[model samples]
Target: MHAIEVCNLKKSYTQGENALDSISFHIPQGAIFGFLGPNGSGKTTTVRILNGILSPTQGSALVYGQKVTANSQEIHRLCGVMTETAASYENLTGWENLDFFGQMHGLSKTEIKNQSEQLLYSLDLYESKDKKVKAYSTGMKKRISLARALLHRPKILFLDEPTSGLDPESAQNVTQMVQKLAIEHGVTVFLCTHQLKYAEDICTLYGFIHKGNMLGFGTFQQLLQEKNSTIYLELRGDSIPPSFTPYQNANKIYKIPITGDTDASQILQGILKQGGQVYEAKQIHWGLEDLYFAYQRGVSHEISTKSNDL
Candidate 1:
């Protein structure tokens, strides 16, 4: 079963203005799905709908085949959510906050102690566990919130800007742990982030949104068929093939724009057949950052060249 599924999900606060417009996508079990967009582009709103905190104006959201609205409490039990504004009780100690949330999740004293201590150790917050949340730094608060979310050992995680206040080291450790949970424990992670480079490293699937519309959704390999991506190979050889024109700046250097994997192969084969002696070849690959900007620069949802492939 799909970990999460949304069908033509739409939301509107005002009469005519839609916060989310006809967006549809699904995330597989144990996959790290990145949901990306600019501020006020409906990223948070979408999360609320999926968690059943807010109902959509139209369409539906399902978590593991359970309708969000009908099974809201059950879904809450299954998901560990760490939102950007997920706050802790300022008067409570770090340990107290975690203990309370753990009880709310119905974890026993033994489970809470084991889970909380482990998370505190892993997050580098064990030293400050006795300190009240009001005295903690922004980074410390973030870590504690994360620990609270993870106390239940939930099967699904919904994290929004999880690393916003974390230092580089802490961020790396957190990501590694999250990856481990997804890979080893079959935890489905729905990550809402603007950290494109970081997301590129960890996310297996991606969905980009702009102005309340889904620009595109798929794995990087699947989205290669879209127009925005062009893998270019610059070949310089002893004998430049006549079929391809030489690059403008360099003599005997030919630039090839490969649209697909097949094109790259065909170009190389034809060059060899024509007695072209390739001395050097440089290829430039388009990554998530590149494609994300490509979508941002677009005017509409028609970012994918292929009507159905991506």
Candidate 2:
């Protein structure tokens, strides 16, 4: 089922200016959809429209096939949103903030207690649950906001930079929890993040926006094809076969184009038989980072060519 459907959505604050151009896409249920873009590219505006916090200048967004508007209440109930500025009560303890929001979501006292404890533990805040939020670090605040968002077991999650200030271990916990929510509990996730390496691990689908325009939207393989991406075997060793090319500006690193993992594995075995000390070897992933820049660069070239024509 399509969890969210956005069609010809546009938002403009000035008479002839647009914050969001007419962009359209749909995210399936239980899928982790990566909504990626640079700052001020209308990513936040689109999120606000879908969350019913802002009204669109034209067109609509439907959540679970129910239309969302600035006045809609039902859509808010189904979504768990954690943004960079998700506010918490500074006077309240970490646990208190969760308890307050959980009650607002209509969770009973017992449900709140059980869920809060579990979340606190999972986010590594159990030991400091009683600490006042004012005294907590920036990362702690982010974690608490995340816990509050999930306290009601929301079916749709909108997370912007979920690991903004987290330590490596804490970020991993958020990653695992996000995966668990999508895979085990069937929650649809709309993720906006600058961390491409992190998003590459969990995102099941992707959408790229630039200058308020949605330049690309599809699954991993589809985007790869869109970018005409190629996979290369990256081998690091003191010596390598003459067939491989030295990687750009990197010593002892060689790159050889290959079809897929099977091809890369076959070539690696053949290299091993030649007895060179292979320090590291793996197929270089044409990951989100690569695809993102490729899309941006394509758009830049198109604009440049049009300008030259004009």
Candidate 3:
């Protein structure tokens, strides 16, 4: 079953300008769906709508086939959200804050205490459990916020830039925790972030958005295929074959962009026949960054061509 679904989901402010255009997508259960875009691209807006923090201007979002607007209370019970700027009481200790939220979620006092201690230990914040939130570092506060979000043991998690200001070690820890939650607990994670590399690491599928429109949506392999981008090869050889053109590279190595896997075998045979010895040959796959730029470039080119045609 789809964990989250958005169809023609549009949101606008009083200015009548849409933050989320008629966007649509489905996040399968147990999948980490990466909502990727630059600042002001409507990523946060869409997340807010899904969480029922903000109402959609038109259309709707559904959680487990339940309309977000119609069943917001139930949706809230089933989802955990951790935003970058999570609000917490500065006067309260880390453990205290967690206990407070636990109670709000209807956990008994004993349950709250036990869960709070466990979360603090897991997040490596046990030492700072007694420390007031105001005394904690940015990373500490972020971790505490995450712990609070998970206190209720929600089935789905909405994480918006969850590791925005965390140190490398802390970020790694958080990423691992997120992966564990999804894999071990079957928690569906909806991650919204501008960190393409990080997103690539944790996300099972991706939805690329720009200017309030979803440019593409699929797994990494699917996106690569949709772009029809070439798989480049780096070879340390002399006297290249006639079929292969010089691609991007430097010293002692040459690169070639192959349109298909079959082309690589033919190129290899041609090189061998020409008495050229290849030291290293491997397919170079395009990453999320490359695909994102390609999408932007394609959009720009389309606009330019249309303008010229007009």
Candidate 4:
């Protein structure tokens, strides 16, 4: 069963400005879907629509086949959302805040207590559990908010910039927990983040958005193949072979772009035959950063061409 589905979903504000323009995608069960985009690119807008915090101007979103608009309460019950700015009572202690949310979710008193304790420990907040939220640091508050989101054991988890202000250690801990929830607990994660490196580390699939539109959606490897950017071969040697065209790099390393795996192997063989000792023969694949620039460049080129035509 599909964990989340959005069909031609669109949203516009009062100024007749469309925030999202007919975006559509499906996330399979147990998959970590990374919703990537720049700030104000409608990533948060899409998350709000899916959570039923905001209604779409057209089309719809579904969680486990349930309509978000008509069955918002049911959708809420089945999903957990951790936004960048989550609300909690400043006067309440961290433990109290979590306990309150757990109770609101209809968890039993004993269950709420147990779950709160476990989550606090897991999030490394056990020591701070008794401290009031107003006294907590930004990282501490973020951790507490995440704990609240998971209190109900929701099947679908939506996290928007979950680690934005967290320290490196805390961020790594949260990332591991997210991966474990999706892989071991069979939870579906919809992660919206600007941190491309972090997204690459944990996401199973990616949806790249720009200017309120989805540029592409697929696995990382699939998107890389579609871009057909290049596979750079770095050869470390003092001498260059006659058969190989040396790239312009001042270092002893020579770089070449190969079309595919076959060409890569052929280049290696040719270098070996010419008595060039290869200290390093590594394939440099394009990362998410490369794909983002390529997509942005395409958009820019299209806009420029249209302007010229007009």
Candidate 5:
């Protein structure tokens, strides 16, 4: 079953200002979907629409098969949301902040304490659990927000730039926690961010938006296939045959393009026959960053051409 679905969803704040164009996609249950785009690319707007914080100008969005409009309360109950801005009382301690949200989610006092303790410990915020939120560092505050979001053990987590403002270690911890929730708890995560590299590391699925339009949507491998990404073989320790002349060389590492496993095997055999020592040969594949830029460049060119035509 799909955790979320959007069909021809469009939202406009003004007569002619569209925040999201007609975009359609589905996020599978237990999948960590990275909703990627540049600043003002309508990612956050789409999140708001899905969460029913804003109504769409046209079309519809559903959470777990229920219309977001008709089942707003149920959707909110089933989903945990953490936007870029951390919302908490400045005077409240980290634990207090989470406890408040937990109560709002209808969790019992005992349940709130148990969940808050687990989250604070896992996120390394236990040390400062009693500290006022205003005194917490940016990373610590972000972790507390996350804890609040997860306090009720919602089935879907809608996190907007969750790792933003976090240190490297904290960011990694957040990523792991997200992945674990999706994989182990069967929770679905809709992660909206422009951090392509970090998204590539954790997301199982991907969606790209640009200029308020849906540019692309699929798994990483699916996106790579659509882009027709090449497989590069990096070979070391040369005695390179004339036919085996590498196209790219860096620090004694020769890179060659291979069509498939058979081609790679043939190249290895040929290299060995030519008395080349096979020190290392690994396949290099494009990640989300490469795929994102490739699509963005194409989109930009297309837009420029259309503008010139007009």
Candidate 6:
């Protein structure tokens, strides 16, 4: 079963001004699903709706086949959410804050203490555990909030820019922890962020949004197919064969449109048969960052063309 599902999900705060369009997607169990968009693209809005903080204007959202609205409490019990804003109180010590939230999750005192200590150490905040949250640095607060979220051992984690205030090392640690939770612990992670490079590193699935509209959604391989990504081969070689005639470019480079790895090998063999002395060959495929920009540009161009046609 999908960990989370949305069907024609939409939201509008004002007449004729939709904050979220008819977006739909499903995150499979144990998958790290990345919700990617620029600010004001409705990433956070969708998160709030899924957490049952807001109702959709149309359609539905479900967590494990239970509707979010009618089952908010049960959903909360099964999920842990850490937003950009830390939910812990400034007056409470880090340990105290975690303990309080753990109890709220109905964890036993011993379980809460053990989980809190484990999280603090893993997040590099153990040394500061007794410090009041107000006295802690932004990174420390973020770590504490994360610890609180995980204390209950929820099956699903909703993280919004989880590494925002962290140093590079801490950020990497958090990212690694997220990977472990999904892959090792069978947790479902829904990550919302503008951190393209990090998202590219960890997310198993991705959905892109722009101006409240879902631009696309799929696994990396699936998206590569959907985008029909081009395969270009750069080579420092001599003499292109007649078979390679269509692929010649300035310099010694050639652009080969290959379907997959096998085609690349075949192309190399063809080049060799034609007596081309290949000094170096490099394959370039579009990554998440490249695909994102391409999608945006394509959308803009389509819109402009439509206006022109009109």
Q: Against the hidden reference, what TM-scores do the models get?
A: 0.86, 0.83, 0.90, 0.91, 0.87, 0.90
User: Candidate 1 lDDT (Cα, whole model)?
Assistant: 0.84
Error of 3 at 206 (Å): 0.4
Q: Which candidate leads in TM-score?
A: 4
Error (Å) of candidate 2 at residue 261 is 6.3
Candidate 6 lDDT, 1-310, residue by residue in tens: 8999999999999999999999999999999998988889998899888988889999899999989989799988988999985478999999999888988888899999899889999999999988999999988888888888888998999998899889999999999999999999999999998888888889999998988999889998887678777766656678877677667776776666665577778888888887878887766677787777666666311110101100
Per-residue lDDT of model 4, residues 1-310, tens digit only: 6998999999989666889999999999999999988899998899888988899999989889988998888888899989975667879999999988998888999999999999999999999999999999988988899999999999999998889899999999999999999999999999999888888889999999887888888898888777766666666775567556447355767667777677778888887788877776666667776676677565311110101100
Task: TM-score for candidate 1, please give it.
Answer: 0.86
| TM-score of candidate 3 against the unseen true structure | 0.90
Candidate 5 lDDT, 1-54, residue by residue in tens: 689989999988889988898999999999999998899999888877788878
Each model's lDDT: 0.84, 0.84, 0.82, 0.84, 0.84, 0.84
Candidate 1 vs 2: which has more TM-score: 1
Candidate 2 stretches with Cα past 4 Å from truth are: 233-285, 299-310
Badly placed stretches (over 4 Å) of model 5 are: 236-255, 271-281, 299-310
lDDT of 2 by residue, 1-310 (tens): 5999999999998888898899999999999999999999988898888989889999889999888984467887899999875678989999889889988888899999999999999998998899999999989989988998899898899999998789998999899999999999999999998888777888999999988899899998999887767766666786566555445237787767678777877887777777756887766556577788778777311110101100
By TM-score, the better pick of 4 and 6 is 4
Q: In model 2, where is the ten-residue run with the lowest total lDDT?
A: 301-310
Give per-residue lDDT, candidate 1, residue 221. Answer: 76
Candidate 4 to truth, TM: 0.91
